[model samples]
Target: MPEITVVKVERVAGEQGQAGRVVHIERPEEWAACPECGVISTSVRQRRTTRPRDLPYGEEALHVRWHKRQFACKEALCSRKAFTESVAEIPPRARVTGRLCRAAARRVASGASVAAACREYRLGWPLTHRHFTALADAVLAEPEPVEVLGIDETRRGRARWRKNADGSWDKLERFETNFVDLSGTGGLLGQAAGRTGSAVEGWLDARGQAWKSAVQVVAIDPATCYRTAIRRALPHATIVVDHFHLIALANKAVTAVRQRVTRDQRGRRGRSVDPEWANRRRLLRARENLSQRAFTTMWNALIDHEPTGQILTAWIAKEDLRSLLACARQQQPRSVISHRLFRFFSWCAGSDIPELISLAETIEQWWPETLAFITTGITNARTEGTNRLIKDAARVAFGFRNLANQRRRVRLACTHQTINPAA
Candidate 1:
């Protein structure tokens, strides 16, 4: 049997000696190649003692006391004549083992804030952030783009800053856009400059035209910049205007009508007022939990009211709401929807409300895409889910004061499949 050597290793708490252990080893005189330079190093210039941490065993931690050596390289042209040895089992420049460092990196990437990850893993904040960044960069090197891409922008950095007692401005928010794959259910494809058309173009340029050509459908909100990019990059693919944005616009109209009626009613009741305002408020208040009789009373009041400025404004506020409800009540038969939808579509297109009219014209121009929802059944729900994920990532990273880091973290958190920590 080969002879064995045992070295006395001490487990100390915070620079003070506590408990100790004897680590068994064979061939303690072997030297490793320099990490910085690929040259093999053999000669030990001097012995430098180092106290490194290890996994805990029972109530005590396993510490490593090794003699670090400095060696001279044989290559004359090499810039480095002398270099120090590095241990593969241990992390680079870290006192802990490779496994512990990787574990810390995983926690930080898995949505734990730097401070929180530090507290839980007993790591320094700077070290955790650095490891996470390195891991994220590795992940970004490999990517898998999917077919159905959804592109959208979000407000990041707060536009308004809070004033401090020192008369300095404190930034509250920042903004960016995320290009994602709705079909494959992966994380983000790429992050953009900002919520502008140029940003979308920049992201597409980075991804290359091959990936963009594979896109069968591009879903987005009513942003012209995004639409223009989709047309330029994915000209053949259908541009689907998410149904939820339309519904949200309609909901805005509903809420606005409710508020307007409520305010107008309050104003008229000062002495005497339009009977319609009172009835409008009552119906809006009973939007939920209304009994049949109550609904009937409000409906009758609205139907009988004279059509005037107040009534016209209130009804205009609710016309989109009425059209949607009417469409929902009708059967799916083309004949029935055609008769009802065209009227609603016309009302939306030609209406005096500039915003509503614009929405209608957009729907008219993209009539095929908009009406495809009735058959194809696509919605903005997936994109919304992705947005929520981005928000959660932002929260985990403690609101990304550094925009580049924020985008990097967003890409990592969303595109997890590309992540390879060991690489």
Candidate 2:
């Protein structure tokens, strides 16, 4: 058994049929200073004992009996009062040792709920929560400067509703914008209430000039809200539209065109029997990933059986967009990508599909941002991963109705720090 400072340890009789140990600890110094005065005094005023919880001893609980003393101030003009002694192992007015408190906090930081950590450590909820908060505060105070930042929003829960004058409820988006440092520690920088320009801008603005100037690039979805905020908060930083988001938009367009064609031709929603409906997933899969036979079968069904070629045209446009994205990923020369983009736009214009046309216009609108992504090869992948962790922590806590607590826990989790004293 390792020795504990200022304490004498011994085996004690079990309580309630449980094994336990008792520690007798006392202040080692014979003299103390009066807190309010600059005088060092040796006059003993009073003595008392306190039993505070300590770290567990194996399967047994350990309790420390601290023999404390108070000394009176000897300064003649002192505001005359006596103060109790304090030790480094335990804070004043605390019922548990510092190590014990840290242990409880570590559990919470490692994904245990506050309630569960309290129960596991045989401590109260309030004390455990305080320790957890302190640990999070220490970690968040010195965030590393970000060079490449990623901004995105995660759905916190279902939309909130408020009753209107007509007794109807209006739904509002329930989201939290997460700012992540992709080029630094890969930890989340901050979270805001909504996915709005003001919410994001406010968080960035609060970071001050130094942090904003350190940012060289930002990866984000093609949302005007985020674009506005990034422009205002970090005007000099280049913006890269996330490749995954752009591909997802193209996929959505393809699905819409398929559904529209299905309805127009059959005069009803697609059923399981419809070949296009049944192989819908195959249609969305990347062309390179599809097997030769499967690809031929799908194309034959779309071309021969389908009366209108709208779905086929839409599929071709979707493939062309995917090829463009793939070309970007390959880091091909700018001229090569430019040639591909030209061909993509020409195809979209000739297809005459409204969905493809709209997609082309959106691509044109964000063309510079897309090129930035191709050149930099930076994406919001890290931000998406961090969001997953935040969501997992929330799920473990059974939903953080209190945003403050949620943010603290997320900080601790992302930094990979244990609340435990052993850590």
Best by lDDT: 2
Mind sharing the TM-score for model 1? 0.69
Model 2 over residues 150-247: C-alpha lDDT tens digits? 99999886677999999999887688898888886748877888889999889888878897899999999899888988998899999999988888
User: Which numbered prediction scores highest in TM-score against the true structure?
Assistant: 2
Please, what is the TM-score per model?
0.69, 0.84
* The 10-residue segment with the lowest total lDDT in model 1: 1-10
Q: Candidates' lDDT values, in order?
A: 0.63, 0.83
lDDT of 1 by residue, 1-423 (tens): 122234555545633565646343333546656655676768767756565554445654455565566677776778877766655664345576656656677777877777887776677878778877887787675346677778777776458689999999887535577777778757577776667777777777677778767778777876777878777767888777776666556555544554555465565332225455455545344244567777677666655654324334434434544444344334366676576567766665555555456555655665566655555455556767767878888776668677778878777777746445443
Stretches of candidate 2 off by over 4 Å are 1-18, 23-50, 63-86, 91-93, 142-144, 161-173, 415-423
Question: Which 10-residue span in candidate 2 carries the lowest summed lDDT?
Answer: 414-423
